[model samples]
Each structure stands twice: as C-alpha cells, then as structure tokens.
Target: MVRVLLVDDEELVRVALTAILDSAAGIEAVACDGPEAVGLARSTAPDVVLLDVNMPGADGFSVLRELRALPEPPAVAMLTLLGSDEYLHAALRFGACGYLLKDTEPHLLIDCVRILAGGGVVYVPPQSRAVMGTHVNVPLPAPAAPELRGRVTGREYEVLALLAAGLSNTEMAERLGVGMTTVKTHIGALKKKLGAPSRVALAAVAHREGLLDTASADRP
Candidate 1:
C-alpha cells in the first residue's frame, strides 16, 4: 500500500482528498492540517505527501523543501488551485515530485499519485515549451555527439514513446514484448542519454527535441 500524508488548511479540502485516496485501493491517506504536516510526515514517514499550496504559516513550498531535506523524503505532490507556471516551476525546483490542480479528475489524480510514488515526475497540465516567453532549448551536456540522438535504439525509442505516453514499466514491457528488467534498463539508459532529471524531464526534453514528432523522426 502507498502511504500518503495529506496537508491542507481547509477541512473540506482535506476531507475530499482523503475520500479520493481512501477509495483508491493500495493507498492509505493520512490527513492533517497545515501546521501539523511536517510533524505528521516525519512521524508517519509516508511514501508520498499531497500538500496544499496555500496554507497557514508555512506554505506548500516550505513543506516541500523540508520534506526533501529529510533522510528518506516522501515524494511530494503540490495541490493547488493556481495554474501559474511560476508556481509550477517553483514547486518542481523546490523538489516537488508533482503539481496537481485541485479540480483534476479524481481517477486521474489517483493515477498521478501512483505515478509519482513510482518515481515519475508529474507537472501541471499543458506542457508548455516556453520559459518566460522565450523558447526554452534544452542543450545536451558537454560535447554533443551526433550519435547521442540515435543512442537510444529504435526499440528503445519505442520504449521512450511508451514512457511518454505514461505507461508503467510492466505495461511497457508487456506492450513491447520485452521483460520488465529490459524496460528498466532502457529507461535508465534513456535518462543518462537525455541528461534528464526524471522521467517527466526526459519526456519534456524528448518532446522539445522533436523526438515525439513523428514528422521529424521515423517511428518504427
């Protein structure tokens, strides 16, 4: 079961989230008001934390940073009513595993929690390529090799596409007729090749590089 610590100032919000998490099998939701979040998180040591962005005293970002500083930090997903990119980027920079809007579909939100708990990075909706009104170009680190683009083999590329499509490792393995271990190995290699910080980062970079554009690359 995935243990989740829920932190929100509003009683109604907490109740709602608790209901959603409780209904989802394999998730244990532990609710707490804003001030008690850190204490509960430390004591409970949940697998993930669903934190509200706006709260009394220390805000969600503060909580997120604190959690990341822990010895065995739980993955944090910031729950907010705001969709501002600034807030979204700040959450990601401060070590938030994901940013989810409050109005998100319950099942999708639950799925996001699962994905984040499984070590995937989740960002706010509408994957934008612009950073501060400028096109953000993700440059490959050091002496960019021509072959790095093709380093991920055709089959591996297929795996990456599936990954971007949000398929789990087991699902990818089944879809590609490969073993789970192979899928894991490919994902690790893909991360290294892309110099991405997470699976979400990898997908963003891939999309930015036109890897997902079928018109740009021949998909097998």
Candidate 2:
C-alpha cells in the first residue's frame, strides 16, 4: 500500500482531499494541519506527501525543506490554490516532486500520488505554462558559468528538460541512469550556455526555449 500524508491549513480542504485519496485503491492518506506536518511525517514515514502551499505558522516550502532533510524523505507535492510561476519555481527549488492546483481532478490527483510513489513527477497545469511563459520578471541570480555564448549539447538539453520537470539532482541522476558527477556537469554546462544562475532560471529558460512543454519535457 502507498502511504500518503496530506497537509493543509483549512479543515474543509483537508477533509475533502483525504476523502478523495482514500477512495483510491492501494493508497491510504492521512490529514494534518501545517504546523504538525513535519512531526506527523516523521512518525508516519509516508511514501508520498501532499502539502499545501500557503499555511499559517510554516509555509509548504519550509516544511518541504525540513522533510527533505529527514533520514528518509517522502515524495512531496505542493498543493496550491495559486497557479503563479513564483510558486511553481519555488516548489522546484525546494525539491518538490509535484506541483498541483487545488482544482485538479480527483482521479488525476489520485493518479499523481501513485506516480510520485512510483518515482514519477507531475507539474503545473497546461494553463499555468501560458502564465509561466509570460513571467520573465522572476529574479535570475548572477551566473556562475564561465561563458554566456555557447552551444547546448543534446544531453544538456535532456538535463534542462528534466530540471524543468522539477527533479532534484539525485532524482535526475536516477532518471538519466547516470552518476551524480555527470548530472552535475550537465547542469553546470546548461547554466553556462543558457546564462542561468539557478535551477529556477534554468527551468524558465527551458520553458522559453521550448524544451519544457505543458505535458512533458523533451530534449531538442
């Protein structure tokens, strides 16, 4: 069975989501407030976590970071009402396995939980991409790459696509069937070639460059 931890501030929201998740087969979901998320997660050691983006006390991102630091971190998906690129970008930076809207279909939500548990990823909705494409105002830090003008290799494009998919360094390495050192090299090369400073910036560039589309991320 896939164990899921659902964290949200609103009681109604938690109850609703828990009902949907519990209705699915081979999945057991438990609900909790934002403040108790980390503690519950540690005790339960769930396989997947559905966390709300905005909550009192500690936001999803902070909780997400703490979860990632655990001895065995669960796959976390940021459940949010907002479809803003800012939230999506932040979720990726914090190593979230998925970014889903509050209005997502019940079936899809259940499937996403299973997917995350199976080592797959889910991202923002298609409509969110249109909004993301127009969001060039997101701050891109100074580049650490040596060159700004260069060619992006085929493998680097693959890396960019996976990076945009919000996979962490370790996740990307596993997905690509490569070593961590190789993955790091590709990422550094992408940053230099694209003149990007952070993973968020790399993801933005991937979207802008058409490597990361709404449904799937593909290499050019």
Candidate 3:
C-alpha cells in the first residue's frame, strides 16, 4: 500500500481526503491537523505527504523545506486554495513533487497521488505558465505552427484566455455558460494549433501572445 500523510488544518478536508485516499485500492491516508505534520511524517515515514498551503503555523512551504532537509525526504504534493505561479513555483523549487487545487475531482486527486508515488510531477488544472519573479519573459510555444494560426476561431481565443488565467474546464464552462465537453473541444483545438503539450503550456503561449488580457479583465 502507498502510505500517505495528509496535513491540513480543516477537519473536514482532512476527513474527506482520508476517505478518498483510504477507499482507493492501494493507498492509506494518515491525517495531521496542523504544525504536528513534520513530526508525524518523520515517525511514520510515509511514501508521500499531501500538505496544505495555509496552515495555522509553519505553513506548507516551511514544512516542505524541513521535509526536504531530511535525510530521506518523502515526496510532497501541495494542496492549495490559491493557484498562483508564486505558490506553485515555490512548492516545486522546495522539492514538492506535485501541486493540486482544493476543489479537484475525487478521481483526479487519487490519480495525482498515484502519479506522485510513481515519481511524476502533476500540474494542477488550468495550468498557468507564469513563473515567480519580476522578470516576465514569456516565450512562444513551438507547437503552434504557422498554418494553425490561420484556422483559430474566436472561441479558440476565449479558451486560450481562460486557460492563461488558470480557470479549470468546469469553471470556464460556468463562466461561459457552456458544457464541459464544449470547453474541452476548444482546448483540444487550441492545443493542436498552438502545439502545446498541456493546458499550462498553452496558457504560457497565450500569455506570450497577450491573449490573457480578456480573462484577467474579467477577474476583480
């Protein structure tokens, strides 16, 4: 079984995550309420740590740093309410294996745990290409060949904008009043045109092209 240490302040989140992880075929979830996480993880020697970003004390980043400093650091995946590049980059830089959003689909969340166990870096939904720094150097994605631009439609642009803004398919569907399938179709087409490997890369390409302005404007 893949032993997991779940660290979050909220009782409900911890319970829900434990339920999800434990119910899965080959995983066990050990819950920790707050700053007690590092000690528990050290004692248990879990395979992975599903850490929350905003804790009462010694927030996730600090916990992660301490974990990495350990002689045998377990894989860590952050569970965060905020999806900003600053948090994502910090987690990754501090040796986190993956970053996941709080409102993730149950199945997806389980899959992410498995992926992290298998030594993969799982990017969260609505992948943002922005990095942490004052220097903003957005590069064009190589996949969007010259011919593809001639075929991009208006809706495709909208999808790219939303992707750049880190909105998930479900979120985008609600905002745009469309079905998830419809949103996915646009995303696939955008990927084909832009040659982006994933939505996050696509968002980076969109930002390079200045398509995120519309979506950013929509935000308060």
Top candidate, metric TM-score: 1
Q: Find the 10 residues in a row with the least total lDDT in model 1.
A: 127-136
Question: Pairing residues by index, what is the TM-score of model 3?
Answer: 0.59
The lDDT of each candidate is 0.75, 0.77, 0.73
- Residue 158 lDDT (model 3): 74
Number of the top lDDT candidate: 2
How well is each residue in 1-220 modelled by candidate 3, as lDDT tens digits? 8899999999999998999999999999999966898899889998789999988876789998888767667778889888987887666456576788989999999988886664445667465334422212435445443455456676777777765655656667887899988997898788777766444456556666555664455455
Ordering by TM-score? 1, 2, 3
Instruction: Provide TM-scores for the models.
Output: 0.67, 0.63, 0.59
lDDT of 2: 0.77
Q: Where is model 2 more than 4 Å wrong at Cα?
A: 127-220
- Per-residue CA lDDT of candidate 2, range 1-220, in tens? 9999999999999999999999999999999999999999999999999999889887889999999788877888899888777787677666677789999999989988887875566775676555445544454553333233136666776777777665666687888899978987897777667766445556766555554452243332
Off by over 4 Å in 3: 129-220
Report the lDDT of model 1 for residue 196: 67
